[model samples]
Target: MTDDRPQGTFVLLDLDGTLVASAPGIVASLRHALHTLGRPAPAEATLDWVVGPPLRRSFETLLGEGGDVEAALALYRASYEAEGMFLSVPYPGIEDTLSALSEAGHRLFLCTAKPLPHARRIMAHLGLDAAFEGLYGATFDDRFDDKATLIAHILDERGLSARDGCMVGDREHDVLAARRNGMTALGVTWGYGGAAELAESGATRLCQSTGDLAGDVAALLRSETGTRAPVA
Candidate 1:
């Protein structure tokens, strides 16, 4: 059958939970920060929520009122830089999925809550940096921490229309941000968000596994008309 779906679709992918199993490193750094401050850190199992969101927001919660969030963040960054960032590895099938998408002519961009420099370094460490056309993310100064704003900034900077792009991630933040910017939201269950959170956030479609990601993304970017794709 002849394919009518658009080629060269702009895809924004999340870094932490979606592409890499980064919780181990992130939680450890967070623990280091808290421990440095003499604050008790939560158990690893309970800190999965910290993997995808902005660190400042997570630290704010971790530190509570009158807590030194800046100090905690500094310590966390120090730890992440020294060792924690190297602790992660990309998800299984992720490399193949990326290769398939790139070979099919899709343009991929890394859009994450992780700081831009760190995101780049991590991708380089994983040898996946070459797959992306650009890596856009948060800054220590708070710029682009909001997913919606980050998506908007990406659209503007790249001169790409919302109709030609899709945001792929494993979180409600990713889905909601895509919808807010009039783009399709493609959620992957293998990531930290799982099926429930993505569904609740009204994802255009959900890929139960990385095996289906490239196909789902291609289909969504092709037929979507700058409106939210029907939940599937």
Candidate 2:
């Protein structure tokens, strides 16, 4: 009883950890912000954990309970916007995957918890702005609290039905958002989230590598329609 899209279709994608790995720059910027504001930096190992969700929550986690969350958040933004975000870079092979998807007659859009400005900047920095027809994300006022809500907004903006599109990401948050919107959820293991997390998040399928995505996705969506043209 799973509803899926046709072979050549639009796919809403998550940014950080999914399409790119912006950890080094993000971690350094966050550390500088925390230090400047007299807060302890989150352990290095856990820095990338902050990439997937909204920045405010990442700041909150870094600040810990009873910490000056607001001040820390302000400092975090100052550093991140000024330079922290530029540290982000797209994962290798991503260009090919995106190009392949587009050339095959599928539309690509971005769906991320990252702020509109930051997401836009990162996309442009990575030469990815043109890869998508639409870039959907939250404003600075809202954080990455609810992926479902964001997905709903994206769907509304595009005048899309759940059966016409799919969601691709590397986190449980991404999968849950797709399911919440009744869209097909596809997970990638090369990003922050692993296979177990994706499965638990109710993803329709998993792509082990970035390259596996185009084919598996073609198959999954093709199966949905009971017929499909060659993806190439």
Candidate 3:
């Protein structure tokens, strides 16, 4: 089937929970870091939330105000770079979804809280390097920990207006980021964030599954006309 949709609709995709199941590696690295820092690790049940946010922030939360967040982060990176980074697995049907979107003429980019180097490694490991036109992420020093900053950077660097694009992610951060940047936000239920979180974050649409996602994105891209700032 020929896709008649217009090209250049930028689709910013979040990594970690949205693209791959990276909690196992992330949590494991956190645990290792905490252990090295002589701190107790949080229970495995509570670590799921750690996957989407900045690692230093997660360490700080677990270790309190006085925690050596830098040390913990360094230790975490040592282990993650060597082993944990490759432990992630893409969500089922993700590759097919990406391929479908690309074929439909949308320009895809990786917008994540993960550091650019690590994000690149993970993408390459999962064979997703070719799926995106560019990858934007936080610095190793945590300069751009928030999604809003990263999204804004992507928009500014790529010369894209919010109206010509949308952000797809599984968490409130993603929805809030897109909202902040005056772009459409599409929440995916298959990720760590539940439906309630996405709804409360004011997601423009909630995709129940990957199958639903491709159609919704294609429709949005086809229907979007020109640039306009998001409504307050």
**Candidate 2 Cα errors over 4 Å, as ranges:** 1-8, 143-145, 225-232
Kindly report which residue pairs in candidate 3 clash with one another. Answer: none
Poorest 10 consecutive residues by lDDT, candidate 1: 223-232
- Taken over the whole model, the C-alpha lDDT of each candidate is 0.89, 0.79, 0.86
Compose the digit string of candidate 1's lDDT tens values, residues 1-232.
9975456578999998889999999999999999989999999999999989899999899888999999999999999999999999999999999998888788999999899999999999999989999999999898999999999899999999887779999999999998888888889998888899999998888898788999988777766343654322
User: Which pairs of residues clash in candidate 2, taking residues 3 or more apart in a chain or in different chains?
Assistant: none
lDDT minimum window of 10 residues, candidate 2: 223-232
User: Could you estimate the TM-score for every candidate?
Assistant: 0.94, 0.88, 0.93
Q: What is the C-alpha local distance difference test score of candidate 3?
A: 0.86
The best candidate by TM-score is 1
Ordered by TM-score, highest first, the candidates read 1, 3, 2
| Residue-level lDDT tens digits of model 2 in 1-232 | 8554345467898998889998887778778878987776778787767778776787777677887767776776788888888888888889999988887667888999887888898899889989799998887678434788898887787887777678899998898778777788889998888899888877788898878888866766655742112111
Give the better candidate number (1 or 3) by TM-score: 1
lDDT of 1: 0.89
User: If candidate 1 were superposed on the true structure by all CA atoms, what would the RMSD be?
Assistant: 2.6
The candidate that achieves the highest lDDT relative to the unseen native structure: 1
